[model samples]
Target: MLIGDVARRSGVSARMLRHYDTLGLVRPTGRTVGGYREYSAEDVRRIFHVESLRSLGLSLKQIGRALEDPAFTPSALVSDLIRQTEKRLAREKELLERLHAIDASTPTDWQEVLRIVELVRELDSPSAARRQQAVLARPEDVPVPAVLLAGAILTEPDTHVAGALRWALARSGGDGVATLRAGAHAEDAGIRRRAVLAIAEMPEAPGALEVLTHALGDLDTTVRRHAALALGRQGVAAAVPCLVSMVVEGCNDVDAAEVLGMLSLDPGCADRITTALVDELASPTADSATRIRLAQALVELAGATGQEVLRQLAHDDDGDVALVATALVGVLKERSLEDQADGHS
Candidate 1:
């Protein structure tokens, strides 16, 4: 077969076949009487092989090595090709995501497009400060997509940046709550914690209450605490058990106790909250430190049940528990007296 026939049949262009010949990748077996390049059957087969390898992302140099180097092993080279292809795929995926985010912004003009691109770039910057400034300075003129903000919020490490991202997410006016709820179930504990915490800050988010309620049972204590705190503030009685547990564990127990106290104002919730606290107090496995923390939490309760618990605790065997209970009871008595005085006036 001549070069033209070889090129037509093998799908390797004539120009590339000549280039391959020049590179000694595949030389025609001989030349015809007119001195044109002539390709033998084996040469055509080699051309087809090179084209096949190129389709798999092999560079010309790598293809040369693959075809001519008898000592070359393909396993290592194939692995390298796989790695390069994966890297290219990842880059393409990132580009597609950025494009989708830009489209979601619905930019009306090139200026809006540029601004959205700039903000997206800054959100992925290596510097947390840049990421934070990007979120804080986000163009209110054009709304940032909630999905984009949620993605940044979940992975952001800086506390200030995360807060700013959450704030942006709150006003993004889209499905941020749903995005956060999905993040709440992430296998990454850090991501789950961030998701719940961000959800907590979006008070107006639809379904946020339900998501937070579900998060209250997360195996990660940080995630649970954040969810429980948020739920407690929302007046969700379901958080009572976790809040009481937080008090026993001394994990933000002060804030937990305050929220629990507020929940106790509901007549139906008051007895339930009191009972949960009493149960933790009665647990034999609870250490003296836990009992002491629980005693401190009792000060936030509003009813006679809290006072009765305090009275029982005032005689406990742990000296620190007794001491705290006695002091809290004293403070409650002082408040009662003050209330009576105001009533008289």
Candidate 2:
């Protein structure tokens, strides 16, 4: 419904909605492309709940929590809202009963309210850090362009506050996301970490491969880890050789296995990867348990090719790799016989 329609139907004014926004009372489900508030049926239901409590003189905070969560059927959430509303309503009722006496006994204290309004002027009103200081300078005054600045953060990454999106390549989102394909070489560790996560979260683009390729040789282990993971998820054959190196070079077990699984699934490219992993299974690092675990992950890639890898794995110096390799080889023999029987069908 339109804000005007909601105002007529629910008896909540348009101005109150802005106040509610500051108090975190309610929010529109969405805004129209033309920039108008849009509410869904579920939003209307939450609004009605807020309206009922407010009519009983409940504070905005009391209604805000209940309106935010829907799984609030249990006591801890709903009962608390009801209790706050009842307590505030009782205080308001007493004020109504003593209205005449209170008015006669006390002069209105505009001084305290004005003092509070003056004190608030020193604290920042949130915008980008550049604008927050300006807003706080005059709290009673409307912060010029604060609303426009907020909308820019969503539409333009450059306008973002000090969070994930701000570091995005200037104003373009994917440009920043694509920045981390090359691992941290000269870049600061924190900057490279932030850039790597940003790019990995975004969908791959044609230019992203070069970045991913460059990252494979990065001096930093973690930046290389994220780059390997992204290449594996992208599942392009161009990444197989690099992923193999990552498995061979990486210290982190889970990431190596993830790259191996994705490498195996890269259609028609499976044979080369399986053959290499089989060769590595026996002679992988003597000092590390990660090698054996990586070999088992290779076995998953091997399937029938598992026999070759298992032979190497059985001879592995690591006791756990030898045991797991022997057991998997036995399982493969049974499966092979079953396949032979099914072939006659």
Overlapping backbone residue pairs in candidate 1 total 0
Winning candidate number (lDDT): 1
Task: Provide the overall lDDT of each model, using Cα atoms, as 2-decimal numbers.
Answer: 0.87, 0.56
The CA lDDT at 332 in model 1 is: 91
Model 2 lDDT, full chain set: 0.56
* TM-score for each of the candidates: 0.91, 0.42
**How large is the C-alpha RMSD of every model relative to the true structure?**
2.3, 25.6
Question: Model 2: which residue pairs collide?
Answer: 181-211, 183-215
| Model 1 stretches with alpha carbons more than 4 Å out | 139-142, 338-345
- Model 2 TM-score (2 dp): 0.42
lDDT of 1 by residue, 1-345 (tens): 888888788777999999998999999989999999998888888888988999999999999998888899999989999999999999998788778777777778898888878888888899988888888876567778777888778889999999988878877777777768889999999999999999998855888888898898899999989989988898999889889988988889999999999998898899998888888888989998898888888889878888889988889888988998999899999999999999999
